[model samples]
Target: MAVELALSADTVRMIVQKARAVSESLPDTYEDGHEGDLSFDTEKLENVHHHDGLAEEEHDDFSESELREIIDDLNVDEATELVAIAWIGRGDYDQGDLDLAFAEARERSTSPVSTYLLGLPLLPDYLEAGLEALNL
Candidate 1:
């Protein structure tokens, strides 16, 4: 079955930055006036994997899958960025890895900002690269 992917790369990056900003702006939503609970889930990651070309890989990276799930399940648009952050938390890739991914993503599409942000500080250079790539 063909899946429909709705987010654009620019949109993804903006969403990610927005998500981070929101989190930082209100570290404790519960303490603040934000009514509602925020949590992460694994099923979302599975869905991301299924859509983000992970399902075709021969080797299974369950941890990445789980990370993708949590990111995908978030109530924010910056799911890719969150997923990248989770990868860093898992020690899956370094800054260089992120940079490489960003460069590759930039070459693949016009929306490098989102892909670069999605990769996050997996490589700090990605931020600059993403900005330069997107002309932002």
Candidate 2:
């Protein structure tokens, strides 16, 4: 699918790296027999969750310049989804909330990647709405 926003390769790489790091640190959601049974420490998870909450509070503090720099590197669709996921990670929303958002997106035939990413954390409703607005 064509990306609505235009992002630089480096920026995209950074976003992907961050997503991977977060995914790796999270507890395994698969069954016991799954090939990768990586699990996270409960204490670490708590700490990370707490920190992520704090990060959310600071999200809006990002200067217009900083926002532009980040947004400039992403396609409109990606940027829309990424920004929402970032807000969610920052503790703006909960998993159940994201579930509702995902359901809405699926009804609209949004990108799987966008759905997957948004489903991960506390993304804002606006981000999910943006995805729904996309041609995908």
Candidate 3:
């Protein structure tokens, strides 16, 4: 989608910075039994991170509830744009797919932003790449 962004580069940058800070503040949600430096294998990290047998990753130090509140504070347009950025960053859509991605983001947003975003380890990188892709 060649549509213009409702969010500016500065705003997206701010979001990326905040998300990175939050990720740093949080402890490892996954426990891979090994010690020393943690290898961030995204798929493995998410897959094994379960409470009981269910797929429920743990949240530590970082207040997901507070994060949710932070994301919830944004206007609907801002939120939808954020999700679109994530989708681009994740390669679910290319930069050309902006409008379609944004529409899908709006449709797929059945959960809170914090829950959706906090799950991704490379969110800041993705957001940054997405902004670059958009030339913003």
The lDDT leader among the candidates is 3
List the candidate 2 regions with Cα displacement exceeding 4 Å.
Answer: 1-13, 16-70, 99-136
The 10 consecutive residues of candidate 3 with the worst lDDT sum are 48-57
37-66 per-residue lDDT for model 3 (tens digits)? 211222332333122311122333335554
lDDT of 2 by residue, 29-72 (tens): 33553322112222322222112122233233333234333333
Please, what is the TM-score per model?
A: 0.22, 0.25, 0.65
- Estimate the lDDT of model 3: 0.62
In terms of TM-score, which candidate is strongest?
A: 3
TM-score of 2: 0.25
User: How much is 134 displaced in model 2, in angstroms?
Assistant: 21
Q: What lDDT score goes with residue 44 in model 1?
A: 37
Ranking by TM-score: 3, 2, 1
* TM-score of model number 1: 0.22
lDDT of model 1, residue 2: 18
Clashing pairs in 1: 16-78, 44-69, 45-68, 45-69, 95-122, 95-123
